[model samples]
Target: MPHTGHHLRAVFRRPDFRRLLSARLTFQGADGVFQAGLTGTILFNPDRQTSAMAIALGFAVLLLPYSLIGPFAGVLLDRWSRRNVLIIANIVRAAVVPAVAAMIWVGIAAEAFLPLVLIVVGGTRLVSAAVSAALPHVVDEKELVTANSFISTAGGLAYAVGIAAAMGLRPLFGASDHGYAIIALMSVLGYVGTALVIRKFTPNELGPDDVPDSGGVSVARLAWHELRTGAQHLAARKNAAGALLVVVGMRVFFGAALIAVVLLYRNYFTADGFFRTHETGLGQIMFASAAGNLIAAGITPAATRLFGTRQWLGMLLPLAAAAQLGLGILFTMPGLIAASFLVAIASQGARLVAETTLQTECADEYRGRVFSVFDTLFNACLVLGLVAGAAFLPETGKSYAALIVISVGYGLLAAGYLWLSRGSTLPVMPAKPKTEPAQALTQLR
Candidate 1:
């Protein structure tokens, strides 16, 4: 491990990793800005109902298509030039965002918010899945963990900074329509930047070429094969399965908890309360959570080393549940705001790093589809969270009891599952060579 660490450092000393890392930062920086600003943009219209609906729809737009398309995306990724897929995906997203912003700006279709948001969301997810699936092709096996860590850190920070920047820019746009337009423009710029960097990459940077099944393959047959291949790879390894299971379960648990957060926030701050009058307070809460996520990303590499990935993630499950419970308790208590935020940041940040690292450790051939499966699970949980949160929060009249029951229950179940599976055999880490900056950028271009 120490020798690998030395090689990791030595590899980065070469310019390729530096450039690849820089491109990652640029792309994710744009992502952070977009995500942070999106909620604010939706809320700018002052129709709380519409804004809330937009938020709901925005999430749906992104998650549903990602889930549905995710199964096939991996197969396509294996068959296509990862770089081309990535570049095209981002460019498509760049184009879509502007169109949506225009419709909203003209007010001709601003009211038809659901369809518009979905178009943008679905498009972005398709692109994102392609990029994620292709990531292993860009970094070395020894440095894969470090690269994954760096990416997760960049992503979380982008989430925080982007949201913060968006909030700050709120006054300039005045309306979410314009704000989203700018964000879309940023997306365009980011994608262009990414495409330029990706153009530098060569085919050698990627995993071994995938030979399509020789047997006459139908669309259904291909999807089934891809899905089963990913599953079989996972099933072959016990520790990897345990790791994957905990992470997937965490996604389901988080879906419910995040829904509770929206409910609590809307009830306590946005809907009506002493806190309701402060406009950006709700935004600040999101900012705080992202901040926590960023912090976790920073420390995750260290944490994974400190706690065995299996044991630590196993334990974090219960701790995260407890954190959610804390969030549920603190939802209405204005005085304990900082404590609530702390818990949230720690829980989410820790989990994000832990899960991503686990997925990256899986086999190279399976990595794309493995991640796709995880993406499917994550998106599925998100959809379920939206429905459950909407149903539970509004109908339950902000029932803390229900929130506690769901959050803690899932946490315990995940923790127990991990504990029992702790002794299981772990998988050998997969091998993948890092792409040169020139090669990664060029192959895709």
Candidate 2:
């Protein structure tokens, strides 16, 4: 196999791949800015009282409704032009951010605040699903793992950069609602940029390629049939299905850990030395995780090549479990930060493999629906984890019980994934068709 650098270069040589990646980085960065600003206002603002239940409720309000819509969105992706989806979704998000910012500005009721934010959040999810489904169109099958790593890692880094930029600008903007509102407004630039970049592609450039006929069916019934068809297709691909299950389990664990960390920073830890404030401490932890993601992006392609996709994923799940037990149990700032770094590496690495598996195994026509299912399950499980953590964890977020449960869950999930993946063969790149010397020479050129 060629060096990872060579694979990256080959992938980047494709024009559509670069364009799609540009759009992904832009909107995901916007997502980071929007999310960081929103969290700062809801969780860290001194004027408001935040608790575990409030946090859980906030997640449910933001995620569950959109998750319900996710499958329908998937069906639409299959029927409609995905290029239009990306363009329109970003435009809707750009329009929605100011409304959210305005709500924050006017001190809108939580009831009003959450629903409006949900629109923006839901749009972001839609764009993400579309992007994942569209990726296979731009890159060759042989380069899928490397291509996934590049996009995932780069997009994650873009998100982290957006967060860091928001945090840095927070002091300048002030930690008040007005400041967060301004920060929220900053995301509009990213949204607009993404929309413009996606416009460069033709309508069918990123595609379902073949759309199933609706044939005189009612809209509602058609959607249901399409969704069911997508589900049945996924069910038949056991490797892809198993990868999704592992992803769901990992999201649950990560979600609970996130809630615990947020509470710890808000209520448990005190300011000292580098941890000048709770918000600062949380930012540091986020940066640490981002760093781990960066490292994973660099190493995962090689790791997967060495161990095979399923085996590497199997190794990562246990590593996450060990990180929780060995480091997270300490419950100190440094301990949590270090633990977060390792957990991030494991999480990002596993996701890279899972994404490749889905893209490789599932047919293009079903890809959109399958990914939408993936998105729905991903968010729904995260919300489940948040709610569960809130029910059991204290105000201070210290709970040996919660930590132990999460760790044990990871261990069991690892065992289950390994068993589920048994006898699944590794994906092999197709050999290039033979060509005449003149044609081959021309292609090389």
Candidate 3:
């Protein structure tokens, strides 16, 4: 077997894979910048008084549209040219973001603000679906795990870089609405960059391979039928289904933890010693999570090869539970940061496994719908978790009860996943005959 470095090099050697990855990195980085700008405007603005419920509501406003349109978007992905979808989606985002920035600049965020933001976010979700659907087309089947790990982790790091850029530039841009508006505009460059990079692919190069016949059905009705078919396909694949369920469960708990952390920084913690303002503290946590994601990219490929995908995922859930418990009990900045790191590793590792499982198990025609379902459940459940946590949490966001419940939920989820997967065959990589180092490297190339 080749080393992890060899696997990554092999994946990146493909020109199409590089192009797709470049697009992903660019758009996701833009997403980070846009998201940070919003965070500054809404959550961290000194003039604004933020609460747990308000935060929950904000999440709902941003995420629910994706849930609503995700399935329909999935159907379009399967039928339409995915490359064009990527290009058009980014163009739409480039157009909509300026509208959002204008709304922010005018300080009128009630009527059209949420709607415009929703449009931008929904477009991002579509781009994400198209990218995920297109991934298998650019890489070989055996390299899926490595390809996914690299793209996912690198994209995340790119997002972190965007956030860091926004944070650093905020002072120059001014921390006021005007500054945030400029920051929001910065994302347009990334959106445009993504479109340009993705244009390198032929119209149908990244594809559904075999498009579903609509049979004179209207798009609305065809979407409904296709969604059902996609759901059935996922349900039939027990491993993929189980992996997705685990990812959803993890997202729910992670969402609650995230909300709590935000509140802790914004309301409870104060600037003293190394601790800074809410924005700075939150930035630290975000960077910590990004660091963990980078680590997961390095570790997961080998971990899954050694332990099998299901078992590795099972192991990660408990680590997440432990991380949650550590933060809940300690309730300090250092604890929060440390917990963020550990939880990201666990969460990202599980996501890598789940994505690979879906790509491996589902046919190309169904992959788009399947990934869209994955996106919908992932975001919807995160919002659901945030809302539920808000209902129970105090203004201080220091609800030990909420944290404990989330930690326990992780444990139960892990146990359930392991039991359900007990009788199933694990997707373990088979060992290859040992070769000279040069030969192994040559094979990877």
Candidate 4:
């Protein structure tokens, strides 16, 4: 059974993929819609700058707690059933949404933004971490690329739809007290759907590592051992380390660059400028990026095959760096907007394929902890970038010289990763249980 293009298409047609896709799209889309409403409602209010900052502070507060706890959650995922975790996580989200809604309705949102948003953001990130870490347990490694591609496509759809809906619903709802409530309802529905679909999914049973450590080891000692073990496992794998470094470094630059883009957009376009007039420019950009994601999803299998290991990673990293550079240069050019959009598509598409493939290669027992490490570092770098970018915020007119300089730094790092790993083979993990059909089918049965 070789994976011809016909076979690939049939792979996409699998019932599991469809259900998972639905769950991803719904969860991501609901997130998008909710954020849209939240940001739209807050930004539209003239007296909310301080409140907005408070909300941001809430995000910062949640960041460390979320990141620090993720690895342990991953350990739990390894030991416990992923299906149950996903279902429970969604239920938790559903419960939180209405609480947020109530706060908004009572005019306490601006006052209690910190605590409320902290709980929401932290909880959401933890759930997402658990679900993502658990993906390899559901799909076979042979199907990893295909499964992740579908996930990225669904994410793209969610991003585009969420932005558009947010923009449209703002005017419809008048960005009033009820706006947040509507978003909460959407989140509730999405969570419910996610929980339902998860119920139908049969996850791979936990291996011995998934069992809770009960040999009289204290929780603190277990946590320390798990962290150390996870780190050792990842560090020992040269290929995984290389891929992780590239992603981690790129996220640092990307996080800063993203914040820079936001500031630049606010300065250059604002709600009163191009976006307010057309209203669709943001969506256009998002849709263009989504199109790129879709294209990436379609071509990823072939690209992964043709590019192999080093070449594929090489091409994507530099391509992403170049895209960021292009964005820096064309930050304000309306004509270059489409190019900018495509650049985002290319970067995100490539990263999704490359990163997930790398993560899926790790052993399942260590997978959660390893992924949590990636998530923690990636997120920490992002926050660092945002903070750094804020320092570089232009006080005057439109000048992207600073961004151009930063992009160059990122480009060099990307090139360095390629150079460092030059002699390496594709590093494709050939030890998957599926390769042993007798064992694989036995597990399936």
User: TM-scores of all models?
Assistant: 0.81, 0.94, 0.95, 0.85
The TM-score that candidate 4 achieves is 0.85
Each candidate's number of clashing pairs is 24, 0, 0, 2
lDDT of each: 0.56, 0.83, 0.83, 0.60
Cα lDDT tens digits, model 3, 327-404, are 656888888889899999998888877776677667789889888989999999899889988888777789878888
Order the candidate numbers by lDDT, best to worst. 2, 3, 4, 1
Best by TM-score: 3
For residue 434, model 2's alpha carbon misses the true position, in angstroms, by 15
Query: Which of 1 and 2 is ahead in lDDT?
Result: 2
10 residues in a row with least lDDT, candidate 3: 436-445
lDDT comparing candidate 4 with the true structure: 0.60
Query: Candidate 1 lDDT, tens digit per residue, 1-445?
Result: 4544554576576566666665566566666655544554454455334433345555766677768778777766666666676666666666665666565565544445546555545545555555555555555555655566556556656655655676677677664565556654555567578767867777435433564563777867787777897787666654555555555555554565555555455444444454442335656665556666656655555555555455445555665666656655655535224534654554554445434443454545665676667667767776666665555555223666766776676577666766666564332222234332111110000
Measured with C-alpha atoms, the lDDT of residue 403 in candidate 4 is 62
Candidate 3 wrong stretches, greater than 4 Å: 428-445
